[model samples]
Target chain A: MSKGPFKLERAGLLQLLQALKTQGYLTLGPTVREGAIVYDELHRLEDLPIGYTDHQEGGSYRLEQRGDGAMFGYNVGPHSWKRFMHPPILRLFRARQANGDLEFESEGEAAPKYAFIGVRACELQAIRVQDRVFLGGPYQDPHYKARREQVFIVAVNCTQAGHTCFCASVESGPRAQTGFDLALTEVVDGEHSYFVGEVGSEAGARLLDRVAHRAAQEAEWNQALALVDRAARQMRHLDTQGLKERLYQSLEHPRWQVVANRCLSCGNCTQVCPTCFCTSVEDHTDLAGQVAERTRRWDSCFTADFSYLHGGSVRVSTLARYRQWLTHKLASWQDQFGLLGCVGCGRCITWCPVGIDLTEEVAAMNDVQTGRFAPKEAGGAHV
Target chain B: MVSLPSPIVVDPMRPRPFRVARVMRETADVVTLELEAQTGPPLRFQPGQFTMLYVFGVGEVPISISGDPQKPERLVHTIRKVGAVTEALCNLRKGAVVGVRGPFGSHWPLEQARGHDVVMVAGGIGLPPLRPAIYHLLHHRQDYGRVYLLYGARTPRDLLFPEELKRWQYTLSHAPGATPVRVTVDRAEGDWDGAVGLVTSLIAPLTIDPSRTTALMVGPEVMMRFTIAELRKRGIPEENLYLSMERNMKCAVGFCGHCQLGPHFVCRDGPVLAFPQVRDWMTRKEV
Candidate 1:
């Protein structure tokens, strides 16, 4: 069928992997290593973590074995797709003198073709957010553009939700809506195990022909829809209506001080976040001071030097730093980028050293007694 | 599986080479470098715009383009030796090569204030960025009404471009609708003959109608705040006043996120912004 809801046997995953490698692609998928589900090169079907699942919450993550042995049954992990698209450290250029004049050689043309498998819907939304930042902006980042152009995406519909998952509340996920070549819903019941594959693009339909698949029946389509509905109901929720205004009014609230006391400013949250794209430029010279290279690395807003002006750093107080990070993530980002920075994947909550749950913190600031914040007029009003 | 042309192929981070044609010492710690592009078209800049000057082996710093806008061949940057990158910029010789990016950020709105009186205020090293606007007003002297300059420095020795200031004062004296150059020193020494007080003192005695005037201010944050308060008292609306703000600008574009103030990035939205746009942000500390 042109628009297929096709059924593939659970064991046909090996055929799909081989088809990808038959073409010129490096297939990357989820696997268990070092206690977390991380993406790595997949040379064979056994590379996937079958029968394994995970439980994630604020400052905690644990692996658990499932009875049915599903290959994809978990939510997002601490590592995001940006680690490959927009690298942590990118060399912008190299400069050297030529006949008493300087010339800059750009190092942004070469990139490997990658096929990402088992991507969650929220993670795909996060990639879209980064595309808006790095590619949709006025000046495009060539390095990110090069790495992003050749990647194929295979999205996985959630069959389960983590304790920290809130993608439904943010209008990002539980199922993939767009920006994918192919999407899959893995269904396993008492005596049945199979995957319902849906083609999102021409490439996907063409690739589906290579794998062993048949047209899905009406029952199988309804089963996939029920799985999506159940996953949506299982996740946590946050009321994001009027959140920007609430954060603006609570900038000076005393709860900031309470949170600052617990924040270590270790920047682990930004490092793990899929949508945070701030960076710092560093310059280094050769030992003889002949060649100079400029590289950009990941940077965090919680650091003291992030807002340094002439005299000193603006966010010197911990209260100011924490407020900057949280407000930028939840509020001012809308004003700047016309979208919320958080995709609601909850990596920040799961990776924080003290388990600082932003949802709870935002709820605390919204409450009357704990936050001690008073609402302003209907429109935005300055204090 | 996926093969498509890149959505965007432009790299905005690369810096072009510009050789230092001349260097003039303005003060003990400050120097102005006149540069010429070694290749490509000449860089175009307007008043209140700045460029990121990168030393060969050192880092880069954002310095205002202080030259006349019409002369695109020659670029001028007046820098003070404050930090590592700035110190490296100050140590450059005549033929030294440096990387140049941008003429970034918003420019002063001089064309909008054509029929109204214009006031220029400067303090310490802030005068360089405002000098281009002054040049524009004088070149098109018939397009505007009366013009006045109010400048203040820490002391007589700390003043920059003394010869140019004297020439401008002379021109203003000879021109029609002449006004005295209101220069002040915070603490005068060595037989100083100018007014001795903060720059705010000069605003009280101006005869121009406040309702039909535009003010362009560039100085320390405290000084700009006090000057704006005095202008507000005289019935000048916040929209009529423009000021320049400074932060650690790593990229002249908006990508780096270092120079963000609230929702706006100073490097992209402005180093120069209208007073009403930044009034609430200026009031909040550590914003």
Candidate 2:
């Protein structure tokens, strides 16, 4: 276990990633797909977002061309690493009646060892947040832990920031500072002509040792730092200080109602959010009526059926539902989970049908409360 | 860890081992069961709290505790043949075994209600949850001010605890320190002597000290709306007014989102709530 900060030639990056894929592990990385850079299954280095850089801002996203063709060129993606690890839907247990007796078997078999590639700093923070919920909560979610324990993390320092991105505001972005087995900063066409890689764990060091990497010099580290700073500068910033209090204090504030108007309540925001883990369980007997399985599927509070009661839905209006969803995400989550819900992934704003930006909503709420945008005469100190 | 008074609010073993001590047909569709704990100790649950009555092979349904919580060892439950689980529960024999989970949910604040006027209102089988509170008030007659009961039934025959009500009314009217009982029926016949109107009408002449007294209510949502409204007219704040709620509760544990009410887990946070605290979310459909 040598203390190592290794370097990899830009051209050899593809061969190293391709080799890792052949060993029965799903090599997941940022790839250009569905008009967005998203994390998904990758088999070869060709799937990497090579020669591509991303532009991100509130309520917008675009891809740009880069002069240097680097394998890790994009910032964070719409799809996160959780999709491969903590899948939205999972079968918790299967029950079958054999000889008139109930047999319940927990479904933890065949959990795969996924080599998650190109995880971003914000995305890494999201993973840790989920770890608190799945592993550090009252009951250990066996499914999540099983998949998480068998996985490998490869983080790529962001070189680009997407529109609708605000990881900078939440203080969890633009650089893979820690929480990854192997952290890489793309430095194509430079003197090193390679990735400035830092290993954070024994597994990361072992993997790096398998690849042909040279000792990174002081100039390599300086170049790597410049790239991270450039990405951070591109990020859309929000004043997140006192954000939790500001959001909760204004539950009845007009901004929530305003945001609700644009919200379609289609639940795409939660679906794409890396940290949202609310789920609904369904128990159904199979065709033979001899076996039954309880399957948990990703559920969003925005769903009308999510809060359905005997007589009707709790949040009958889309406005009420949206308010509840956002407030819970940014404000009350701190009260319940002891942490801010948003990890600044920007997926919610990007995936929103109307592109409702939370950073904008917070700013509006603050203005509305402080009389910043009032008619000047219609204002007194708000309670 | 001040010894979380009740460590397991929703015990894994629901519908605790209660053997049917007696079963009687209350109506063509409903039955009342006198249950005796088959194992260990009886449950000391609060009024308004419920249990997941489990019929081993069938399933589980949330049923209110109709029996005395004080004499928990010998429990009682009433069920209407509505859903599969309820039908299974109604079909149990006097000797059949059943599992129970709970005494879950917040109960009427009995200690807080002491030394204050107490008003209880019930509709249909909602009587079961209210019965415990009614019984508790009667047992401790001198603890509070006026103790009035306003009850409503869908029809004369749908009335539960008919014999018990008569005894309860007599106890209140004759017990040197008791309060009067007000009763009503939605549809009445056969020379019924009680008021024939919605239960809300009974609260018009009723005495309620909103700031000081506590009002406990249970019924269909519509009935509760009107009943609680009457209490408000009588100047009772939502906090002092409480109600018991029922929904499709799959797991008595807080893990399931089926019984969630906003930020609260109805299974854990409350089946009973301070009206003001829940009034906003209560009207919000599923909550």
Candidate 3:
């Protein structure tokens, strides 16, 4: 492998996939499935969403033809790499009763080594945020730690930004900075298509050596950087100046009630989000009551039962539930993990059925805070 | 290839089994169960820490340890039948087995409160969690100044450990370094002769040095809030006051995200927290 930035032609991309598979990694990448691009098992280059780019906005997503034959042309979709890392459902342990005595056994499935082919910069930061939640504490989550440690990241720098894309505003994306094994910038000029590859780890350099590649010229590297910069300029902005402090002070700011009026409480935003990581457990028993198993599944704060105690749910009204989710993501997460929960991926904005864009909501709150908009009468009853 | 750290072998979710040795009914809806481990050593826990008690076919709930900390051989828990899990736990008889994953969260800062007058305020079922701390103070009676226990319940019949309360109020009050006990009720009944009002009413008559007093309280959120206000008016600094909090907890190790009170996980960061640390949060509703 060359020392600096190297160039790989369209055919070399297939060779890179082959090299990763030969090294005993399960290659996962983007593919068109059910009219949406999602991450699935990839065995060949044709398995990618070639010549397809996504058009995204609040409450809408569509796949369109790029016509330029670019393989990695799309922004992020509804699925994230967390589906493979943390998993949506997991069996925690099992217990069996015999002779009035119970025996317990842990579900000890071995973690798999995965080569993630198309990780975005914001998604990478989301993975880091989850790492802090699961591994940074004194008691580590064994299930999360095992899979997270074995992941091989292959990050892709964005050349085209979707309408809802705001990673540039959060300082988390458009260009892959760190937390990746290998970073790629796809360069398509008229009839020529190639990837500008930069090795980030020893493993990435070893894989690059197996694929045929040449040192990139000065002009080619400059063109790659210019494309990412253009993508950065195309993104929408989210003003985060003192946002955490502002949200904490605005717990009863009435904007929550306004949003709750439109929100159906369907929880689609949490399902599509890359950084929301709350879970609840359920216990199951057999018909004879001999065997019992406990399973953990992803849980959303939108549900009233999420905060249920002995008597009843704490946040009974939709207004309180929405306030908890938003404040926890924007304000309280900083106090808990020392970092913002959102990476500005915009998946939540695009997938929300009512098109409740968080960036717009924050701007509205700022309008009231700065006295740009008149405050409504404080008569809205909250449970 | 990058080398990663090996996974920790101990799983925090697994619960050990314990057999019920004796069950004593404290009230019509509350019971105290003494448990002995089915296997392994006994559970050693500090005062104010809680355990995740699990019924075989039912579910699990967080219950604070109510026994003496020094007497770890017999694990004791006082439970009120509030939900399905607690109902099943209260019905448990001798020789019945249950699961327990335990001894989690912050404890009362008794060590830091040394040499200061200790005042404990408990309401309803909250006294069980504070009972262990009272036992600790009595065992090490020489380490503290004046000790007082102010307790209240819904009614006289609802009071727990009736015989023990009598001994502490009558016998111990005459002993050196005595722990004076004051009892109150929300409403009076037939043949009742005691103060009848909210527990905060009992705080006015206590002769305590606010500067040197350490107040520990446990009760419902509204009760704690009012008690905190009364304690503050008495000139007790916020840092010297402690309160035990309650929230819906699934994972006691802080992974479930169900027990979050603002940024703090009540299962891990507390069951007991300083008044100043949660002063701003307690004022907000449904946080």
iRMSD for every model = 5.0, 10.0, 5.0
> TM-score per model for chain B alone?
0.94, 0.90, 0.96
Model 2 interface CAPRI class? incorrect
- Candidate ranking (TM-score, best to worst): 3, 1, 2
The candidate scoring highest on lDDT is 3
Worst 10 residues of 1 chain A by lDDT: A374-383
Q: How close to the true structure is residue B177 of candidate 2, measured as C-alpha lDDT?
A: 50
lDDT of 3 by residue, B72-180 (tens): 9899999999998899999999988888888899999999988988889999999999999989988887788777888989999999998999877744353555448
> What are the DockQ scores of the candidates, in order?
0.48, 0.14, 0.40
Q: Using lDDT as the measure, what is the rank order of every candidate, best first?
A: 3, 1, 2
Off by over 4 Å in 3: A190-192, A370-383, B1-9, B170-179
lDDT of 3 by residue, A130-217 (tens): 8888877767788887778788888989998989999988889889898888899998765457999788887788888888999899
Residue-pair clash count for candidate 2: 19
TM-score of each: 0.94, 0.76, 0.95
The chain A TM-scores for the candidates, taken one by one, are 0.93, 0.90, 0.94
Q: Could you tell me which residue pairs clash in candidate 1?
A: A51-A69
How would you class the docking of model 1?
A: acceptable
Please tell me which predicted candidate would have the highest TM-score against the true structure.
Answer: 3
